[model samples]
Target: MYERVEEMIQGYIWKDLGVKVIEAVDGEVTLHMPVKTRQTQFHGNVHGGVLATLADMSMAAAVNTLVEEKEFTVTAEIKVNYLRPAAGDFLEAKGKVIKRGRTLSHCQAEVFDDSGKQVCFVVATFYMFKKE
Candidate 1:
């Protein structure tokens, strides 16, 4: 399942963002991405959108682990708190499922810079659906 998810990441928006799945098990996932110039703002800090993307992707990946092969999930809503400036060569996002329901999943994620300082925290809800 981890290999399949890794392969799917290569074809999604994650490919453009350079996100790589480092670990995936049960209802948890860990991902990392290098801090490239293109992902930063003019002030040289990682952009909020990029951090949010990392959080979202990680949470979605966690949700995926709990669903069937034919099932998929979508981000229904996400709330993020930017705690500090993300300035580093790389960042890691860790996500875990808080609850899994018949149609919805509650998840949380945290993003940290290479220094191990947390840069952002996120809580999200995902809706599960079957492939058409």
Candidate 2:
């Protein structure tokens, strides 16, 4: 499952984020990002969009863990709360699938700084697709 999700995250989409996989297990996954190649806005804060992408990717990985081999997922809707400004050496995102259905899954992810201070909270829904 991790391999499947990891493959989906590859290519040009998040190619520059330098995201590293920490752990992947059923219904949960953890990801890491370094500040060296971090994308920041003009104000020098971590770009909100990048954070949202991380949240979405983590949630997708979590959902993939519980799905059939041919199933894939894409974010259908997402709500992100920027709890605090992100600043540090690195960031971590931990995602979990709270509920699942045939067509959609409910998931959540929290992005934390190096000190483990949560800088963002996200709730998302993922729509499932199957290979024909």
Candidate 3:
């Protein structure tokens, strides 16, 4: 189930965000995204928006794996904390569910640089809507 969800996200939405899932479990999702020239800011560091997008995507994917098939989730709120400058080979984002409710879910994501150092952290709440 996790692999299926991962593939669905990779084959669908993640290319737009430049992300891919490396691992997924019951409560967690691990993703990787490259920090290329186009992704850098004026100061030459990876842009904060890119980091936030990766974090949000990771959390959404994690929530998707746990929710019912007939339900879809959308981001209700997201807060990102840029802990340090990000530059180098790639970025890693790991997301896990912190809480889950009938109509909403809360998840957290952390991004790391290629050297395995933390770069950013995010907490997101999602609204789960039933499919019609």
Best by lDDT: 1
Across 34-132, the per-residue lDDT of candidate 1 in tens digits comes to: 999999999999999999999998998888888886778889999999999999899999999999998899999999999999999999999988885
lDDT on C-alpha atoms for all candidate structures: 0.91, 0.85, 0.87
User: Backbone clash tally for model 2?
Assistant: 0
Off by over 4 Å in 3: 1-13
Task: Single out the weakest 10-residue window by summed lDDT for candidate 1.
Answer: 1-10
Determine which window of 10 residues in candidate 3 has minimal summed lDDT: 3-12
Instruction: Show pairs that collide, candidate 1.
Output: none
TM-scores for every candidate against the unseen true structure:
0.94, 0.91, 0.91
Per-residue alpha-carbon lDDT of candidate 3 for residues 94-127, written as tens digits (9 for 90 to 100): 9999998899899999999999999998999999
Give the per-residue lDDT of model 2 (tens digit) for 30-101: 989886534787778788888888888788888988878788788999999999888778889999999998
Per candidate, the number of residue pairs that clash is 0, 0, 0
Shift of residue 5 alpha carbon in model 2, Å: 2.2
